[model samples]
Target: MTVLNNTLTFRRGLTLKNRVIMSPMTTKMSFFDGVVTQDELNYYSLRSGEVGAVITAAANVQDGGKGWEGELSVASDKFIPSLSRLASTIKRNGTKAILQLFHAGRMTDSKVLRGVQPVSASAIAAERPDAETPRELTEDEIYHLIEDFKKATERAIKAGFDGVELHGANTYVIQQFFSPHSNRREDQWGGSLEKRFNFINQLVDGVISVVDNSNVQNFIIGYRFSPEEYEEPGIKMADTIYLVDKLADKELDYLHISLGDFKRVSVSEEYKEKSIMQYVHEKINGRLPLIGVGDVRTKEDAENTLANAELVAVGRSLIIDPHWTSKVLEGKEDTIRRVLADQDREELMIGNGMVEFLDFMMPERLR
Candidate 1:
């Protein structure tokens, strides 16, 4: 029998023990102020020993970037100790930790920011029915936000994290700037594809400067991107390929690929059963280590994706079964639980609070 071990290494010198990586799952379990909680610690630790790396839920980089009530935050130094503890717990359990730094952009609820409007490429509102309309960022504000990302990267390093993944997908601030439908500005940050890419370039440059220094060489810098906007027609695969090529020289350790926007929960279901990374892998051709995510639930799916890509990312599957990766590696495929469509939909739409809902939605064995 062929042993299906899913370990993979990248040119950047970071080696994942298995191809199964836990994709960032938003639990909304953090405190209202974004402090890490014991529940989150335990939840992540349970799966840490099973996967290669655990990318945490998005941690907002600035106060203005705070989008949801329970989302994690790294905007302040005071949050460092707690974040450091979380990182240590995951690493102690044998999985590398990567903090996902994000800016909610227009998707942020206005209530959380205390009446301050969310910022994005233009004064466009998120397509999500529940999202608030956002204020367009001024030229100066956009430049300042770039610096904020750099500072956040520095903070992640200070928190003893192994790496940081930029949340550029799911219609976040970076994604807003990338999509022409959202970024209709007539300025340097908006007109052509090159200009649309300028924000991401500056963001990567700023973060790399802080993360790739001699002292921080071991820190992996990665990006989570969705080239297609789901329902929006403007952003295409070619744009994403161009963006990937642009960042190929930035010393990125990995690329995590996910499809659809945060506002479009419906499209997420389509990606839930497929590996979007396979397409991205073929496009990049191993230019950098690729992390394939989307609807991977079984050992067979993980092995197939890893054979073609560098890594496989599991989200809902891990939430339902923490030891999923270990079971797959040990050739106990039958032990792997099957996730239902409704449960997957609930998780993606309701975020972290859907765990209890999932228990009710799935059979006892699957749950």
Candidate 2:
């Protein structure tokens, strides 16, 4: 087997057939009521069988956590039937399925929240030009949010997913709490660096406790995080190193970093020379598997990425080539289409919303 064809066993002993995991991309294909639509199922089914695993688009863990239109939800048991369809569709191709759990926090627009003020660790606004300052979450609310995540885990367990990936990356609630720029709480939820991690600590502990008692074999838990941010008082490589150290010791199945380029250099001046992936990998130090992701488009790219971490996640590449892993394994790498074309949309079963996203991302080709 090629490096990409290798089976990967998580800490919980849940194994995947290959190293090519499909990175979660927002499909915007779910129903407005937070139900998983047929479009969502069809989309996942197309790409599910070929990759080692398919991580579903971020599903809000609670009602207030929804971030985008058509985002999936595991917030309530009422949504379990739809969630089960999502999990089963992905697993039908014999691939391991991991559901991503998320909360938008201050990143959400009030309009999206139906006029509700978005909540965050502090009332700080994002640096975006039109970003609104969010309402600070009260202590009771913070604890409730922890339960919210645990509840989502329960839903995932009931839905029959292989695992759940905490959406700690991007500018979501988890990142907001971890980021100094966004978190200004003087209470237990935020303040000093260690206190900032308190939320995640309790969250992981809570989720793990549930998974432990579930009696399901190989129900793994993974975390995805952005290593650094551009905002002042934001997370930097040094801070990420600290966070990784703590997370690694927690017996997580894997640590997945969010990046646009696997080889991109650090935003922090002191860590300028080394790539962000390298910095994170060094911090992990093989304590747990690390899934390296970015613009890993070609077989060579995947192999090179494996040099830094244990696995590679193909996002846009998978968006354009649903059978990317299958092609690589079958020595049909030369047949892969690297760019999107207008004509290819129909056969790929692309939904109207997904087509719009592709159009936005690759306008020239889609046109």
Clashing pairs in 2: none
Best model number under lDDT = 2
Show where candidate 2 strays beyond 4 Å.
359-364
Residues 1-367 of candidate 2: C-alpha lDDT, one tens digit per residue: 6888888888898998889889988888989979999878888888888898999889998778888888898889999998898889999667988999999998888888898888999999999978988999998999999999999999899999999999999989999999999999888888999999999999988888989888889989999999989999899898899999999999689999998888889867899878888888988888999999988888889998998999999988888889888888899999998888778777777777786667655565645
lDDT of 1 by residue, 1-367 (tens): 3323545666557777766778887777788888998877877777787677899989999999987777899998999999998899789555789999999998787788988878889987767787776888988999899988888888888898889999998778898999987898888999899999989988988887786564865678899888577546467766776777777656788888784211122234444343345445666776787776656767666666566567778876787667787777777878865654545444333345655645543345343
Candidate 1, run of 10 with poorest lDDT: 259-268
RMSD of 1: 5.0
**TM-scores for candidates 1 onward, in order:** 0.87, 0.97
After TM-score superposition, the amount by which residue 263's alpha carbon in candidate 1 deviates from its true location, in angstroms, is: 22
Give the TM-score (vs. native) of candidate 2. Answer: 0.97
